[model samples]
Target: MSYLQKPSYYTISLVVVLLLPFTILFASFLLPFSAYLRGPPPIAAGSVVAGGCSHGAADGGGGGGGGGGVRPEISILVGVHTMAKKHSRRHLVRMAYAVQQTAALRGAARVDVRFALCARPMPPEHRAFVALEARAYGDVMLIDCDESPDKGKTGSSAEDVTTGTWLNMGNKAKNRVNIFPRMYDFKGVKPEDFLEDTIGVHQLKQDLRWAQTLEHFNVTWLDPSSKMTNSLLS
Candidate 1:
């Protein structure tokens, strides 16, 4: 250790050799317990929500990265009756403010937005468009229902869907809400609005009666009394 006895290569090598095995052993031991000290934080509700992804496995993949193997918690059956090749109602539903809210709920909750529409006999051009939308968005359930369209306000068409298909759609998710479109601006229906929240949307019931004129139509009361207090009425 004297100043005159400056350290040489051998001395350095000797020290490193003595510490190498202990260093390796220490790292090996620390590896197993490190995860315990730096473990993941406790699970928080909605942190791992299904999340309404504009792309629900759009890559043709099955599930999300973190939400692997998790099925949709809520199923939304939205009926889309195509009035014609260019149905304004269908387009409006896609871009509605309520639709945005529904997407938010989907992302935060296990809710799935599905549209029940008649795909068959759709104009070839419209059919292509339907396919494009279906491919892009993991929503919309199109079926082949035998029905006719309307002309200058004359005709009728039942939803083009089989009971089995409808039932299968219902069975996909744990809980579900069947939303009647044409009554709402958009598929922006939420489980909360009708099931629990009961504040925003004014849901209609089949309690009212309807008649078959030139075309079949829905007639229902302004729920919770026909006062029109709900925002939907406004």
Candidate 2:
């Protein structure tokens, strides 16, 4: 035990063995306390995304992350009723909406465009593709019904069943205005028909037709540092 003598291997091993458990215990207590001081991670912007196709909402995850900010003044949800087979058109429609999310629009209102699909009769391949697509876009809803436009299986407003009918009740009519020929276009969408004012274009089911229509409004991504290319339709 001379002060100048080098410690033996046995002595060194004994010292380390005695200190190891204490070191581990200190870390175990300190790690959680440090994490607690940091607080829970901030919830991502657009984390609560997607509306269900059925009457109820379907919970899922995966979306872009950003810091929180003041809620937009207005919130609008445009639900497009579609079949599961139209995958390409869905992508085009998503791109169309995404590009239109300009700085001005983001500041004033939050517009979410989600697709509704009938889930009952979906084919195996369609189901798999729809699941992946919903996960990727976070905007698809699967309706539990047969895929039929005439069956009225899509959905209905609960107010419709109330004793008071809106149509004939004069002043009791629902607080809504017709958007046709103004905010929405029900007519078949053409390439030249894509206008800056219209909020929606309907009946563009054909892939080529939809692509052409989107090409009219597709804004070219020009940032040199970014890898995104111009519209594929071009």
Candidate 3:
């Protein structure tokens, strides 16, 4: 008998070798399954990707980038009378051109230009003036007051002066008294029988102010006697 026999080195080495393969296999299987058993994967990485997407959108990238474009800032309405004096007609046409050029310079995407004309018997020169003005400005609208029920009204006063009268008047006045007859009305419509009350200087000013209030444009009235100044349009 003698001291207790020590474990053999060979036996210990054999045991380690046998366990190595099982340990590797167990580790391989446990890794993926363990993650599943622990519930969903961590959100930090996914959150980072989502955060990047949101940041791009806010920076005007991705599908939302188109919103970065600028919109039009102004619109113009020019009231022209076909029966106006030769000088007056020419002045209005020149004013319309100036307005269009100014709008282009100001980076406006649109100009809602309208011409109000008396439909009674327009002179040939006046018709020619309208054609030239229309060619200069892409958007042209004509209103023929003769066909309008509101025609022949004294002093630009609405036939019905109630709270919603202006709206009704605007609706009914649609191009009935428009300036460009050829552009707006294909079928020659005549102005209503109503007579327009003559407007005075003070009345004209008041009407202009009222019109300015209704439009989004920066109103610039060009008088026939005034010299044409590009700076004023700017």
Candidate 1 lDDT, tens digit per residue, 134-192?
Answer: 55554545555643455211134433344435567878544544555313421233332
Worst 10 residues of 1 by lDDT: 209-218
For model 3, how does the per-residue alpha-carbon lDDT over 28-142 read when each residue is reduced to its tens digit?
9999998988896655421212122232222121111112346455433433333322434344444534443542443553333334444445568866765554444332234
Error of 2 at 130 (Å): 1.2
- Winner of 1 and 2 under lDDT: 2
> lDDT per residue, candidate 2, 1-234, as tens digits?
689899889999999999999999999999998998899666653454454222122211211121145667776666676778988767776666666665566667766667878887888998889988775667787767787655644434553353245356665546565676644443444545555666556656566666555656565445655545334334
CA deviation > 4 Å runs, candidate 3: 1-69, 73-111, 138-140, 144-234
Model 3 scores worst on lDDT over the 10 consecutive residues at: 58-67
> Clash totals for all models, in order?
4, 0, 23
Q: How close is candidate 3 to the true structure, as a TM-score?
A: 0.29
Tell me the whole-model lDDT of each prediction, alpha carbons only: 0.44, 0.62, 0.41
Candidate 1: residue 197 Cα off by (Å): 5.4
